[model samples]
Target: MSTIVRVAARGDGVAEDGRHAPFAAPGDTLTEAGEIIPGPHHQPPPCRHFPQCGGCQLQHLDDESYAAFVADRIATALAAQSIDAPLRPTALSPPRTRRRATLHAERGLVGFTAEGSHAIVDMRECHVLHPALFALVAPLRALLQRLRPKGRAELHLTLADQGVDLLIRGRLPDGLAAAEALTGFAQAHALARIAVDDGYGPETRWEPQPVAVTFAGTPVPLPPAAFLQATAEGEAALVAAVREAAEGAATIADLFAGLGTFALALPGRVYAGEGARDALLALKAAAALARRPVVTEHRDLFRRPLTTAELDRFDAIVLDPPRAGAREQVAQLAASKVARLAYVSCNPSSFARDTATLCEGGWRLDWVQPVGQFRWSTHVELAAALSR
Candidate 1:
């Protein structure tokens, strides 16, 4: 018998001999016949779509085992670079807390894609979405049934300060009957806003007023399909880490700052550089209206990152980059005079690579806070602090 000692990066169980087993838990034992014997850490998945759903990869593990998995993801990433730091306990969000999600729709089917397949799950129940977002699913199914030529589309759902803001892509509420049906659907459900896109761009078909997201005690207008942290708990964890890292700094440069997630909350003079026009304008307007000292700039970091010479002027820096990570930007930061830095990332592999670059430049890894925002999934996020 081979005992499963750990989980691989993609959620498969690994034995001491490097043999891999799917759906096996950390303590599970594999028999010579290649069968998984249930272990103490293995729990019956709550979701009916568990093994088939691409949305999650670790639902079979118990709570303690799941938490360990999240923590190990960060620890392993750091160890890969031969770096060590005082890592705080990982924060895990509860199920049904997801504030934003993307669901697929085709013909009469609606839900997430199947694992490793394009076939739709047609969700009858979802344990990951906020109740409000899930509440729209049935009605959305009805609306799609009424207003379509039986074509494929996508549903982008986000719970805003006002209510659920929905965007449908690849199709629209076409024709007068379809348009009327859509208006009735939006009004009946009392949705905050609804829009459609036929590949060109999203066009607002209905809006009660404005949609916004409240972060760090401020209400920032929510742009269509704007980036948002998956869960409220996850956002709080990231923000607390960033605030602790940036405390006492008089001036801070927030790079890749999407809609001023940190700039709106941070103290002192803050400059935010974003690549999205709508998000940049929204952040600027919100800052001015609230009389906050946050300046916004529109620049593509991938094309031209903030130069080291320019980055040296700030007392501290904050980086919240996409999953691809900020290799170029981190390279520039490695040569700058900034004393403190906070990096929030959703990809552990990418984060490790960039942290190595910063560590090679004499910066020390102060601490890291792992967050399980997408609960029961292999995806991991973290907020880390570095100092000279």
Candidate 2:
């Protein structure tokens, strides 16, 4: 018998002898004949679709083991770069708190795709999605049955400030009846907005009022398919970590500032830079309306990252790059004279690579805060504070 000691980055459990097993939690015992015996850290999956649905991967792990998995992901990545930093306790978002999700629909089935396959899981119950968002699953299944959309359709659901915002990507029958059916569905659910895409871009079908999402006490217009933090609690955790890292800084620069998640939350003046024009415009408009001292710039850091001299103007910097991490931007930041930096990332491997660059340039990693926003999944997010 072999004991599983840890969870890998791809959701597989690694045994003490380095063998891997799927759906096995830490402390689980694996027999030579390939049977897994549940252990102390293993728990019965809460959702019926546990191993089938690709929505979550670690549902079999208890809270303690799950938190360790999140931290281990970061620690392993940093170890690969020969870097060490104080790791704070992991912040985990509770179940049913996910405010945004993308589901797939085909034929009459509507749900997440099956694990390692393109087939839909036909979600009858989801433990990860917020109640408001999950409530629409059955209704969406019904709607898809009526529409009988050819091929696969994508459903993007988000809980906006007003109510649920829905976007459907598939061909729909064009007629007054189809339009009325969509309108009636939106009205019945009090949806903030509903749009459809038949190949061309999304076109709004029902929207009595403009849809928006509130960030840092300010409401910003929500663009169709705009990126948002998965869960509200997860967003709060990341924002709080950034705020703490940037404390006492009168001037800050927020890079990859999507919808002002950190720009509006931080104190003092802020320079917000983003690559998405629509998102930047929404942030600029929100700042103007709130009378916040935020300057917005539409810039692609990948091609034209802020120079060392440009980065030196700010007392602190906040970077929230995508999963690829900010290699080009970190090059400038490493050589800059900025007093402090808060780095938020969703990919530990890429983040560790950037950290190596920063450390090579004389930056010292102070601490890291791991956030398990995409709970029960191998996906991990983190916020780190660094200084010269």
Candidate 3:
């Protein structure tokens, strides 16, 4: 028997001899016949859709083991780049805290897609989504049945300040009755907004009032399909880490500042740069309305990164890039004279690559804060502080 020593990045348990066991946790024993013996870290999955629903991967792991897995993911990535830093305790978002989720509906079934397949899992119960969000699943299934959509439809649910914001993408039965059904559903659920995208673009079917998402005490207008942190606790943790990293800086530049998440939270003048026009405009409007000292710029850093001269103006910098990471921007930042930076990323491998580039430019990685917002999943997020 080979004992599983650790979990790999993709959630497979690794044995000493480099063997892997699927859906196995650390300390699990694998028999010669490939049967898995559960260990202390292993527990019965809460959801019946375990190992089938693509929504979660590590439900079999206890919280302690899950935290270790999250931290190890970051450590492994950093080690790959030959970089080392103090890794703080992992901040884990509790179950049922996810405020945003995407589910699919087809043939009267509504839920996440099946693991490694396009088939829907027909979610009867979910453990990861917020109660408010999950409550709509059954209703949505019913509504879709009424509409009787011939093709599959995608449902995007986000918790806005007022209530749930739902966007449906697929063809639906078109008529006054169809319109009335959608409006009635929204009103019954008290949805903040409901939009549908048949093919061209989204059209609002029901919006009692303008929908917005609050960030750092400021309400920014919510754009259709806008990006948001999975959990509020996770966002708070990242913001706190950035604030700590850029402390005492009077001028800060927030690159890839989507909806001014980090920019509005930081103390002092903030220069917010984003590539998406709607996101940038929303942030700009929110900043102006709140009388915050945030200057908005529509710049694509991937194409035209801020030059070293332009970057030198900021006392500190904060960047929360997409999964690909800010390769082009990091190149410029590495050569800049900025004293401090807080780098936030969802992809550890990309983050480590960028960290190596910055380190080669004489910057020292101070510390890293690992955050597990997508609970029970392989995805990980982090914030790192670097200084010259």
Per-candidate total of colliding backbone pairs? 0, 0, 0
- lDDT, candidate 2, equals 0.94
Sorted by lDDT (best first), the order is 3, 2, 1
lDDT of 3: 0.95
Residue pairs with backbone atoms closer than 3 Å in model 2 (clashes): none
**Greater-lDDT candidate between 1 and 3:** 3
**Which candidate, 1 or 2, would have the higher lDDT against the true structure?**
2
Q: Model 2: per-residue lDDT, tens digit, 322-386?
A: 99999999999988888799999999999999999999999999999999999899999999999
- How would you encode candidate 1's per-residue C-alpha lDDT over 135-178 as one tens digit per residue? 99999988787776346898999999989999888666558887
Residue-level lDDT tens digits of model 3 in 44-163: 999999989999999999999999999999999999999999999999999999999999999999999987899999999999999999999999999999998769999999999989
Ranking by TM-score: 3, 2, 1
lDDT of 2 at 227: 95
Off by over 4 Å in 3: none
